[model samples]
Target: MKDELLIKFLLKETNAREDSEVTEWLAAGAANQRYFSQMELIWNVSKQLAVTSTVDEDAAWNKFKENAGQLDVQRPRVRMFPGKFLKAAAALLLALGAWSAYILLRPGYTTIESAATVRTEILPDGSEITLNKNASLSYQTRFSGNRRNIKLNKGEVFFKVAPDRKKPFVIASGNTTVTVVGTSFNVKYRNDQTEVIVETGIVKVRNGDNEVLLHAGERALAGKGINLAAQKNPDQLYQFYRSRVFIAHNTPLSRIVEVLNENYDARIRVADPEKAALEITTTLNDENLDHILEILALTLKLTVVKEGDEIILK
Candidate 1:
């Protein structure tokens, strides 16, 4: 145990195990026992000092000042700068100010807003972003000198980032940060969880020191305190929101409906929880909602009932 921890044990502040550990350490050798005895003596002396408050603060300060003055202390003298040096300093300061202003107002940002509709936008670096409804992507116009950085303000976005080995692309959403040199990935910010699904290339997702690398068909979750966990992506249903095509390979019904609800304005609710686990392998490409629902109802032996805005599957 450390001296500080042993001090805590000496004060009866530590638990039984800590006390025993300190006791065993003290009993190991004469040096250890001597160290503990000295510390104990100091502790007892400190307790006496705490009880007796007879020391004069101002008198001690004055005594120290007198003693300090008796000892010779060297002090450095300040030198004056020449006229030419002052002029150069002024010019340097002015140049620095101009540079600061240029950096502050650097080319501004290009913001693409996809409000209630899926939209695609090409970034300045030739990277493509397919944004979901209510999602917005904003990045600097000039990515030449600066990092290829983008911010997902709300909702989800699929990024097909162009390869820039020197300048890595970084996407920041809430506390989560996804960095890549060149990659295609889906980043979704939902219910305080930032999910990263990599379609191609490699992505490094970090929330502080808790970071995880994700490759193609791999997914990761980044959050506070390094809850870095990655696994094989369960499905690629997130792409449906941007592609208008839902491809399922032995996917569960519950998982399909979850993606469907996010893609369409209307909500798709599975009435029976037990049937959600049923595996389905199908491709939905530009199919009408009514037709797709009809097919799903027939295949799964479930009834599809529409009540107002919500579609209920029983």
Candidate 2:
């Protein structure tokens, strides 16, 4: 009975048992001594303006506004005032303190916009990102206090995260969870499997029961099932994230098609696995997809047809 009450009070979230625990804890003369002492500390901290607003990146100020468009400006959706007394015990509050995170810092879950074929961008917290092709990434603006989390369901992006001894950046896509304190790396999770390439950073990839750490120039491959692939790199795996390539040398046809679709919105499908598995060893210089496709057809000697956004190859 005492344990559950303590937990809820700590979290500041309430339930029926709360009243019972308070009565019991207070009824015991010695227990009241501890409880009131702790409450005094909490109220004192709340009274200090500096301590109340002193959320320094690590505390994760996840206070949301009603419309939730802006934080700290006062809105109906805002969960509750830090100044308000949350009816939680020390332990529960301490546990929730870990969850004290900020949203994407921007109004709406942050929207990463780019019009260049290749561009480098930075987040509100000084994290660097490189966008390739026509990729759009969106995340929360209030990312500091409660959750330093971002969701990616498509495209390829490389990140060079700053060291915040306090908060960590979390990237979630499908079942792939990439957690980092301070690291530089790249990820391409547009397809079935998440392809992560770390350039110079300490990154941990969690997929199901597997938790692998990438030191530098390492690659971790994750997918739908249990067979997770973790490969080390001398230099080859990170070659793409190393320089950012719009083209590949002797790249498989399947990979090429996927790249074109994501990069230029050119949907090309190789109906034959025999043809899709074929490797193309040529440079795709500044030419458009049509020009590149024409060159491939002539060189590979394969039948090609484009219908709407679909390209069928036999």
Task: Write down the TM-score of every candidate.
Answer: 0.65, 0.56
Best by lDDT: 1
Per-model RMSD to reference: 23.2, 14.3
Q: Each model's C-alpha lDDT?
A: 0.72, 0.62
Give lDDT tens digits, candidate 1, residues 144-173: 343676877778899999998878998888
Model 2 scores a TM of 0.56
Q: Please list all clashing residue pairs in model 1, or write none if there are none.
A: none
Supply candidate 1's per-residue lDDT for 220.
Answer: 85
Name the regions of candidate 2 deviating beyond 4 angstroms: 1-109, 113-119, 132-148, 164-167, 190-193, 215-217, 232-245
Query: Candidate 2 lDDT, tens digit per residue, 25-94?
Result: 7778753545445544544454443334433321232222322222333221224333233322222234
